[model samples]
Target: MRATLIEVAPRDGFQPIAPFIPTNEKVAFVEAAHAAGLRRIEIGSFVNPKAVPQLRDTAEVLRRTAGLEGLDAQVLVPNARGVALALEAGARHIAYVVSASEAHNRSNVRRDVASSIAEYGEIVSGLPAGVRLRLNLATSFDCPFDGRMAEGLVLSRLEALLAHHEDVEVGLCDTTGRADPDHVFSLASACLARFGEWTRWVFHGHDTYGLGLANVAAAWRAGITAFDAAFGGLGGCPFAPGATGNVATEDVAWMFARMGVNTGVDLDALVRLAARAASLPGAAPGGRVRAALLGACATT
Candidate 1:
């Protein structure tokens, strides 16, 4: 089976660190991701620099990456204003995040459920032609503030969002790393049932409790071919405190390669880039299988 892994190492992974990474390093990260066969990447966000200090250089990063052939540059926009900035910076793809939990959503965007939906609609209305918008429904798995929310709630929320726009891709985020394989399969089945076939659903898994790979496999089995993973397992939700980084691109690459699954990613190259991110101040290097296989631990 073929799966597309949108590497979030540069954006999501690097967003919550200290000694802010320079723009050059961010550029290098995107370049290395491309070298590793990652054609889609969330490079940065267009929020207030004070809100997310890590992405203050977003415009410069997107500008430097706009000219890269064959690589799709996507940036996160919190609202219509940020969307405009992304288009000006040459980002052909933009993503907006909304959480299932009202508490998490409010904390992240200061908007309650209905208002968040309105904002999502407003953002959708202002998109430019050819610019893909991905609406990430965070906490599709579990919310840190609410805890173990039912699939019905998540499905209902997703349906409501899809009711606003039919063409946009929906991201099912396993925020707080609370997904099990069974959980993913059931939730994905519900999504397919509610949203129908035309809507694209991408699974975004976190590794807080280390079932990320299994959950990815489950979702893939449940008809989720598009997924979001981070290079070197970098990034956590800034609003979801204590949540871990995303599943590693290298780790996912390794998992899929052996399964005869084509992720179009080079595992070794991702490992190198991950090492670079890990070396940065306050960056955490994750992906156990990646570290073991590529580092001193791989016996093979």
Candidate 2:
């Protein structure tokens, strides 16, 4: 089966940067991702403008790219209010993040695990039917403040969320880049065993330790087909210390191509897009493929 790679750079990558990417530039970024054959792209978050000024123009950005062909626009929502705003802005796919680590969850959203779950439940109940919900279990592999996560604890959180909302899809996120291939497979296997054929899980990893691709491969073997990657490896958890950018979209595309799995992304076009992102202030291409492609083009 073909895999899905969701491009989260316009939201996740630009969130931690100091300066706001102009709204037009943000739209251009989305257009580039769409042109490169990415069907799903996270345009921005619908949170407090003061909290994350970079994404304040999410509505405008979404408005600009709303009617693109074969494009699915996703936006992150922190609460019911955010979800309301996202829907008002015509967002069809919405994502919510809750950390598996209690300390990290409290730090990220100012809510304890139980409280966040309750709030998320309320948010889900209030959503209008037909809106796709994506729940990210952040800090799934390890917590910067809490160290490694117990597999049982992760499974328990998953069970708790599923209990409240059975229709939701979940993403296992390595929020602090602490996941290795072995640990990733073990946790994925545990989740698979307990959930038994619930395939709506996505692997979201950061490359802080340079093990992003390895962990991705492990998850793929564990039967995960959906992934969250950023252009140029440009993302980090603003609340999670020591976190780095996500696995580069182009890099993953290259790896999957070699492995005979199709991602439907144009590797060469993605490299060009990454190069455009690297030109923006406070941005840099952290993935290897863009550099490699540049070198190859230079020699040719």
Candidate 3:
């Protein structure tokens, strides 16, 4: 089966926590992930230090991992400045996040989603030779302030972004972990039917409901393959309260491995990476392999 795994442990995994994750340690995590055969990583993010102190040294983190072999590093860009910072830091690929909810977008970025989308287009306009871009439409499954998101609404916004973007990938986010298997199948099916040709369809599912793996299977069944997972399930949304972990990278790899799909990722090495991941300052340790590895270390 065709499958591509985008690791988000570095950026999404450490950002929501309280303490500072040393840049060296972050670099180690990235290095270890590469050894485990993970090629694509959302390595860091460009945002205000005051907002996400854990990733305050984004520039340093990216610089530290500048020469890793067999790894593709990416970061989350909130706007044009973030994009510029990413470009300056030698990132060839970046992911832009704009919440699907207007209120969430304003509360998070001080602008509505439309404004952010336009800004993403502007960021694209000024792109250099080889850098690539992907946009994450967060809250695609559901929104907090706004209840029950309509599929039509998500597609409409998606259509708008696609109209403006020619070479961008779109990752539909299950921000709060409220999505189920049926939901994933329907959404992925519709998304592939409509946008698969023009853009790559990536899914960001959370383990909040213990269905993150199940949802991944749903997307796979729907003929969608690209996914974003956290190292040992490291990250969570800062805006969504009670939302704790992303699907663990090791767990997802294991799942696909057993199903005869190729993720080009090594589960045991990734499980070892989970040990270092759990040590990241204030990291909540939500993924299964991460907790298990750390627990074993404690028992030993």
Candidate 4:
């Protein structure tokens, strides 16, 4: 089995940290991720600095790392302004995020779900030639404010978003990390069946409940070929109380390796990078592979 693991440590992983990570360090991490055979990476987001001060220097980071060979550097854009800033920074791949739950959407972007969908249309119409778009339905399975999202609501929102554009990638995000494996599998299966041919599918999960990897496996069984993970599991949604970091990239790579699946990531190199990320001051890191690997070496 072959899978594509889109590294999100630079963007999702670093976003929640209170202290600003130096721009140079952010570029280095992206370079290291490329060296480790990760072709796609979410380097950062172009959002209001006041909202996410951690990613305020996204333009500079994007400029510095966008030229890395074979690197499909992606940036998150929440609105037309974000899209403008990202494109100004020479980003060709943009991930637009909107929550499935109305309440969560309001908290996340200060807009209702319908308003976001309208904005999605405007964004698609305004994107320049050759730019790629990836739609991330945050809270697709569960919402921090609304609790477990009804499958119908998720499907309807997805259908509405896809109606705007078809040539794009879609991510069903477990924003609060409270989603179960059964929910992940069922939703993934449903989305794939309904809109499988319309766009590419990706799974974004978190380890808050110790079900991150289990949820990943469940998505894979439902035929999801691509996933999003943060190295050392450094992430959390500021708006989602009690949510933890994303599923660790190293852990995902380890799990795939053991299952005879090829993720094309150099585990040793990834572990080294994860260690550096975990050591960052003020970073709340999670995940077991790094510690488990260190322990195994200690015993030997």
Which regions of candidate 2 are displaced past 4 Å? 196-199
Candidate 4 residue-wise lDDT, 1-300, digit = tens = 799999998989999999889999999999999998999999999989998999999889888886789889999988888999888889999999999999999999999899999999999998899999999999998898889999999999998999989878999999999989999999999999988486999999999999999999999999999999999999999888899999999999999999999999999999989999999999989999999997898899
Clashes of 4: 0
lDDT score, candidate 1: 0.85
lDDT of 3 by residue, 1-300 (tens): 768999997888888878777778788888888888888988889998888888888888788887888677889988888887888788888888898888778767889888988887787788887888888998888776775678888888888888887567889898888889998899889988887466888899899878988998898898878999998677887877667789888888878888999988877788877876776667777666556655777899
Error of 1 at 291 (Å): 1.7
Q: Report model 1's TM-score to 2 decimal places.
A: 0.96
TM-score of every model versus the real structure: 0.96, 0.97, 0.94, 0.98
**By lDDT: ranked, best first:** 4, 2, 1, 3
lDDT of 1 by residue, 1-300 (tens): 799999887788988886788899889889888887899988989988888998999899988887778988888887677877878777788898888888888888878877878888777776677878899898888888999878888878877888878887889999899889999999998888777666998999999899988899999899899889887788898889889889988888888898999887777777878777777889886777666766564564
Quality of model 4 by C-alpha lDDT: 0.93
- For model 3, the local distance difference test gives 0.83
Candidate with maximal TM-score: 4
Clash count list over all predictions = 2, 0, 1, 0
CA RMSD for every model? 1.5, 1.2, 2.2, 0.8
Reference-based TM-score, model 3? 0.94
Deviation in angstroms for 104 in model 2?
A: 1.1
Query: What do the candidate models score in CA lDDT, each in turn?
Result: 0.85, 0.89, 0.83, 0.93
- For model 2, residues 177-259, the per-residue Cα lDDT tens digits are 88999999999878777774543788998999899999999999998888999989998988898788989999899999999
